[model samples]
Target: MQVVIEKRGASLKVKDGQLIIKHGDQVQALAFNTIDSIVLSKATVLTAEVVAQAVEHQIDLLFVARGGKPFARLWSPYFGSIATIRRHQLLFSRSPEAVAWMKNVLTRKMENQQALLYALAMPNHATDKIIESAVLKIEEDKQRLQQIEGAKLADLSPRLRAVEGQATRRYFQAVNIHLPEMYRFGQRSRRPALDMTNAMLNYAYGMLYGRMESALIKAGLDPMIGFMHREEYNRPVLTYDCIELFRTWADWVVFDLCRQQVIFREFFEVEAGGYWLAHPAKRILIQHLTDFFEDQIEWEGLTRSRYTHMSLFAQRLAALLKEYKTDKNKK
Candidate 1:
């Protein structure tokens, strides 16, 4: 994988054939071909041209925003995958079978979330109970959703929002349990994460979000469309919805590694009311996450690696959407 490691806080630009990285008065050049993901930890200078080049090459660009939140993301237009578009359109068309299939998929997703949360809250039974309660709430929501008949879209909206909020609350609570004491949150905090662990979580989550965005696009699902999440400005709603299923698993892996000291604290620092991972730690986290993706996972009586499973899931979602479109065309 092409890796662009940004070590200093500086401005970044792409001119001619080189990536111009500037920190204060110093500037360094890296060839475009040598970089896969452009990781900005504490880098200061970045230009539109740099982003454009990275997008053109389908390079995964990651930003470590304040709070050590690492965001692995790419612009929507450049990274658009044809397969994802087709699948998304297929799924969006409302149909009986389509809705049923979506329900089943979402149910499976919740099951996975429950399992991951249980694992993450090890030695703490409270987390498992919370997940169990969320499961019940999901059931209630599913029933309410199915019962909607000529129901105003507005009314249905609030119900779905309630269910989503409950589920999210449970998930976030579990996430906080794994965080460092300094970064443990009482409520939602944005931008700069307060401690090293939270910073890593933010950055790691960004990377995962980008990957999920790619997957949704490949599945032909509109990233901005969602079932459990409301449409919001500048947010890929569907990506957030689907990510709920897998985020816990990813978080578990990273937290475990951190707790084991596999990723040392020396690779990070506390600054400006937030934490930042050093260049070396960022590299290690990315490498380890890559490994985590390659590691095998068990689902639905089959054992397959996460990378393989993700690809397969995208294909399956695409196929389901195609079926929906076909039936619609017949009608």
Candidate 2:
């Protein structure tokens, strides 16, 4: 599983080949094999031995700032799969197969959104109309997505984004209906979230992004080389592409927290810039999100944890890309 070191002044060390974490009076030791990743979110001390052992055992070290945004990641340079996978990945970005993959990913995302709305809809309620309308809009966009013909992502990017953008607006419009008035938002905001809901959602999405990037890297895929997303300097565009499939997962977790009223204004710190989650709010979001990801769900006709589903998809995509005989590499 994942070990989150979020407590201020926490420190990690290696003792007898086991991972030792100490914060205040609490101390815990974890076996190296049992730990998948370590997320450092607050002031934490670690020795060189700890980093070496983590890399030796293939454990990832992800660092995040106060707003839950991942700023850096550490892993062994020798961990990526054979260079053949990445060779094909670059060619795959412009191929017809890439177009198909993009369409499939987006449609699946829209399908998940509709499923969420359907699950939330109930009988004899004014909100049912709102939810139903949102589902219809998303479905219409999904149909439009399927009808679009393109040889490559360039041919499809703009129209695809338009449909996805419209559908997302409708989806969030319905989602905001469920939020308490104090937490409801007019639009999605980032950088500095203007409302409590936006702040929580942004933080949760950031956490998801870090996990998804780690998964892609472990599968021997290059997170910077994207199929549908535009390439930019020093950006993990592939993570952005793959994250579409799982955004709803983060949305579900945050929505549940909001509905439960477990989050309050006091949990947030309002700044001249906007709003940020206090340390307590961050802890609550992390706990709930970690638990939600570990919960088993029906995926690909089998029961698997949501975290496993992402890793499996990354591995499968890497395998599939390796099999493709790109035009440049063809005999």
TM-score, every prediction? 0.64, 0.96
Which candidate leads in lDDT?
2
Model 2, stretches more than 4 Å misplaced?
A: 327-331
Tens-digit lDDT track for model 2 on 1-331?
9888878899999999999999999999999999888999758999999999988999999998877878998997766799889989988888888988999999999999998887777688899999988898888999998898978886688888888888999999998987778879999998899999999999999899999999999999999999777646789999999999999999999988888899999999999959899878989999999999999999998799999999999999999988979776678
- Residue by residue across 1-331, what tens digits does model 1's lDDT show? 4344455666787777788887678878888776645656545667888887877766666665543344445543654445644554534533345345444555565556556655665464655565566556655655655564432332354654555456556666765666556446665444666655666677667766766666666455676665445446667766666665576656766676656665655778766766567777777777777788768878656688775576566666666555544434566
Error of 2 at 12 (Å): 1.2
Query: What local lDDT score does residue 74 receive in model 2, on the 0 to 100 scale?
Result: 93
Error of 1 at 290 (Å): 1.8
- Clashes found in each candidate (C-alpha, N, C closer than 3 A): 22, 0
lDDT of 1: 0.61
